[model samples]
Target: MIDLLKEKQAVLDVQPAQSGASFAPVLPVDIEARAVSKRFGDTPIFSDVSFRLARGEATALVGANGTGKSTLLRCLMGLIPTSGGSVHLLGQQANTATGRELRNMRAQVGLVSQKHNLVPRLSVLSNVVHGLLGRRPGMRHWSQALAPQSSRDAAMQALERVGLADFANRRADRLSGGQSQRVAIARAIVSAPKVLFADEPCASLDPSAGEDVMELFFQLVRDEAVTVVFTSHNIEHALKYGDRVLGLAQGRIQLDATAASLSAAELRGLYD
Candidate 1:
């Protein structure tokens, strides 16, 4: 299955740039979650979970299943209301932001989930171009396309970064799982978002593919200065790729440390 995806990806036209580019934030973010908590009726997910992601840093959220990792991501994105405390993104309160405020805030962050979330019938290029939806809301349809040439050019360039530019004309559903994930990464980064949130980005991939995807993510972080926050179940990958790892258990952060400083015993204790 992986080999087939790689073959289908061969058709993509990746347009490498003359020189790599960097994304410097106009105002750097000190993302902080202060005493945040969440609950579903009688079930509590977290209590007083606090942490911060300094600008230009990559943080890995690691935990066993059903530990509220996804819920925390949604909370950071303001998709759901928090039961207590607050989430600050780029210094803006996430939970209380209004519709327009939320939209503006969301424009600064890009999300890539385990699911590609692409329209199956849409062309790969079209799906990538949809990354501009937050920027060009007026051009909602393929027929009514109004994105500037620069935006399209950027999207194509992003595809190239992920090595999938040639698949631009193919339907999204035709690509393999790995290829689709690559496309999703391109879409997330094309917008030059200040923060990139990836939820279990390599969850469905085999070991090799998972490493490749994680390497690509780190490359983006180093090359583009895009702050990344991702959830991962793999402890080795977290230690290898993450500058810092936050281990979550029972809705709260159990261990937060630099990868080099984290020991196997400490990591094992996080799950206990």
Candidate 2:
């Protein structure tokens, strides 16, 4: 198996520390949102929201249905344009970034949503290799035949990290729901994103399977030192897995604190 730590070191080599008097020091925050809001026509989804994700930490967003948790996550990932405010992801301003800049910035950010979003017909390893498509200049996405050895190594390493290296050749559609989710995560990690955004990652799994997936996800993030921001409707899962929790209600953050400092009983009160 490829050494994940060594690969991580190689990845870090590309990210040299900035210096010189004219260059401003970079913020430690991996993600920063200030006075952010989202709306569809006249209907406001959320307003005046702000938060920061510290490096190598996991922040969970919890709320009832219609509370805009997913919408807010999408906004942070720059998948959708926000109605107001500003967002800086990995020090790149989302609002004014050019297409090429956004593309490059996006390569450093990974996302896993409720849907597995895998190409069912492809082998699990190939699906993970797709994560490098953007990173590979002028390469045809579907031409897996032309994938370089480095890309294959990274993909295999990602699968190894997710405990799916043995199933690299299996078709994505043949995997179980839980396995599919893991594969999606492997795809996300193959990109070696500094920040990983998961939207209700366990929503489709059975209780036991969901718990297992959550455990794997948290461990992977911790080992890889990737910052994570995820939204979950499962209060127990959020309280159990998150280092920090942000409770959203009626377009506002009703509560924000370390998960250890908050109890399930207190979180339930927000729902009522």
Candidate 3:
């Protein structure tokens, strides 16, 4: 029965960039959560959530609003402490890493939040150049005027990939919402980090612009083999863009399966 469904749906996006490559098993679990939990004071946001992903894979996180999707992402990134259990990132323990070790671990990953997170006064190029802060970590790369020519070049190359190089010198405040999101994506990919996390990156844009951004995003990251984990409310997107689908509902992972192994109807059921 599962084989018949798989043949009927024609799943998309597992190994999207390299269509010829087989959907191999996820081994080595570069990112993992073991019985993780989160709370705000006495209010438990979630409990006992756990999953794992391999390098170069893409997973889509979906759940009803207030299910703690964003909070869970932060925990995995080591931005906040988990209430209980453990998270492993790049073979390093997330909760116990020292200050320097924590910084080093974060440097290997990228994040594109729902908000653009760009400095309004800075130029578009400068915002993208900030992606290198994880690697550069100094006053030198703070702005285009102070950054070395090499950094500027790398920033420009990233903008070019997103087709935004011409706007490199424009003030970030002047761009439209869609354009701002594109710059955000450029910033996320500029470092070519091993992992990328996006929290509803296109939620603010119109449908057309959002579609374009998602396409451009997948194209760039998959080409670089950057492992991706993004949260989205769109069910079709979960089915279409992720190698795996993880559904969070009632404060736990209610569904865990490959995109190809699941159908849109199955995902929608998780919402209620």
Candidate 4:
């Protein structure tokens, strides 16, 4: 017999399931930022910030506006060069890597920005297939427009995992904010990255929608056992969802502790 009550309960619950698979003991990935600094010509945005992100963990970076959070993410992603020091991803020196090497490194890392980066003109399935583009070295422009049947199947599965399978044929730009965010997440995970970086993923959503999106993120991290690092301005959300909370002020890490370890008062001090 079908259990209607259980199905209904599943729809209401937002908490992610705990990881049950035991990961093999491997050398921890050393994601380190050593004395990193950034500047736009003469205007310095951040200076002498350093931190390390260990493998197989979730870390939340929290701060006020203009605290260099986005700049730090860009630096980590190697989108922009830092003025001083360096960033190392999985033990590879990001500062010295060539374009090809950097692209290789980026393949292992996934990013979901505040602004959804989906191709508006494409169908939802096509946008998800973009995750596979990093794997195809020579495929680009019009040549890559027609995704293979296998890739299309994979994209459909990804959308199904995010509960958007029914909308696979819809245009990405036509979806609601929450649905768009889920599609963005589906695209990120389709590549099966080792680490996922989200920059204020729920910044534009309403309270309920934000919670729904965050719930999906947590589920992805736990189910896939992918390392997650995100930046957010929402303290309550950080406290509720983050495994490890990092408070950044003035472009430096001021507090690093488990979410359970930080009291409300302590969190306020970090923000202040």
Candidate 5:
């Protein structure tokens, strides 16, 4: 059963599940920020920031507070417009795409933030089902009670991936900090998104809980072969979980290096 699930998951991740299995090819460059820049009024947030994320790549965005890491992330996701340059996602010009086109592109993307953002009154299963809203809308997705069987099953599979299947029926408010974060991760991956964007995802947890959640989160990301772009205040996480590190400082990309080639000390220097 485990092997079967693994095989099925690879298909959801757009990879070939097994020998001779049909596959969908993701573009070589999943995300590209071409000299993008942002500003709020006269205050510049970031300028000339650019990077490309390949399919299934994991990159970490690291920086000191107020360097606009979050702003840059939002721009990359097309949640906000860049002041200059452009962002391309999944073969479309994200910033220039039509409304429907942008929505369609975003349907294949997922997000996880520091806050769990779960509906406290709802069951964990229902919260996970909500991740499908970008693709599956209307009252049917409002709760597990109204959700179709297929939706429920997908939500459960996502819960299982985060090791929270047993808590599917529990209320979202009844979970521990670590458990809530797990549910958040399950929600993000429920749609088998081509790319996952996480902004300080562990920022709200204590050290011990944060460490545990980050481990589980990255492990699941690897198992599903998902591309990821996450911002981290923790240098250890930046080096440990990412294939490449994109550092922000002085209103620009101060450092862009392979994580394998970057020492912790060198990355820490960017924070100074």
Candidate 6:
């Protein structure tokens, strides 16, 4: 699957020039979730979940259905309030950051979920360009048929990253399930995010397409040194693709270990 994706390579990114002589410094830890917990009134979602992902590292959350994997990702990304503890991204407390500070922090993060979350009637390029809405405002996002040339060019580059440049003019709803998911990925990464959150990114595709999407997702993030925290029902993909594997069950992290140290059977046992 990875080989196939590699064969269909397209342009990936465009970045501003930096100092020619500056040394590359090691990036700090990208995500820090300390004893994070979530609940709905009296019902517990998950409890005391603590973990960290260094820059460019990937961690996969695995458990049975209704185990709060998605909810935890939301908490880390500041989309929802955690019942207890805190999540820090890029050294700022996610729950405490306020106003423009919070917006700036979130602008550097991205999410790709099971749902493509694209506007059906919009062209694929327009949907991907929506990612820049964080960086550009005051323009009508929904009503604009054509974005600024720079935004369109960037969005096209993003589509190329996902092997969908040729489909840029196609209506989003016209694409297949796998293509839609890839478009979602392009939209998420178009902003050059420092961290990305994905929830079951390949759950809706067939085995082959699912693997290809996962590989593409991983490659794009790794190429730009984006930290990733994703949840997956496929234990094998989690173990094979993630540097660290975390098992959540019965409202807590039952197991946490390097992916290389844990077998698929051990991770699967958390579901039972």
* Total clashing pairs for each candidate: 6, 0, 0, 0, 0, 0
Q: Each model's TM-score?
A: 0.86, 0.87, 0.90, 0.85, 0.89, 0.87
Query: What are the Cα lDDT values of the candidates?
Result: 0.81, 0.83, 0.88, 0.79, 0.89, 0.84
On residues 1-272, what C-alpha lDDT tens digit does candidate 6 reach at each position?
22222232221123356868786786588888898889999999998888777898899998899999888888888888889999999889997788898889999999999888999998888888888887775464442365777778788899999999999889998999999999999999988999899999998899999999999999898898788999999999999889987777888877667788667766767777
How well does model 1 score by local distance difference test? 0.81
Q: Pick the candidate with the highest lDDT.
A: 5
Q: What are the runs in model 6 whose C-alpha is more than 4 Å off?
A: 1-27, 140-145
RMSD of each: 11.9, 10.4, 5.5, 10.6, 9.9, 9.9
Which TM-score value belongs to model 1?
A: 0.86
Q: Could you give candidate 2's per-residue lDDT for residues 1-272 as a string of tens digits?
A: 11332243345336577677787545489888899999999998998988787888789898888989998888887888889998898998886677899899888988887799999988898888888876775564443556877788889899998899999989999999999999999988887889999999999999888898999999988988899999997888888889888878778776667787667776776676
Best by TM-score: 3
Please report, as a residue range, the 10-residue window in candidate 3 with the lowest summed lDDT: 4-13
Which candidate do you rate higher for TM-score, 3 or 6? Answer: 3
Ranking by lDDT: 5, 3, 6, 2, 1, 4
Q: Pairs clashing in candidate 1?
A: 11-166, 12-165, 12-166, 12-167, 13-165, 13-166
Q: Tens digit of lDDT per residue, candidate 5, span 1-272?
A: 22333343344446444666665675599999999999999999989988889988899999999999999989888898889999998888888887889889999999999999999999999999999988987899999999999999999999998889999999999999889999999999998899999999999999999999889888988987888999999999999999988888889887777788667877777777
- Supply the global lDDT for candidate 3: 0.88
Task: Please identify which of the two predictions, 1 or 3, would achieve the higher TM-score against the true structure.
Answer: 3
Clashing pairs in 2: none
Candidate 3: residue 251 lDDT (0-100) = 82
Query: Model 2: what TM-score?
Result: 0.87
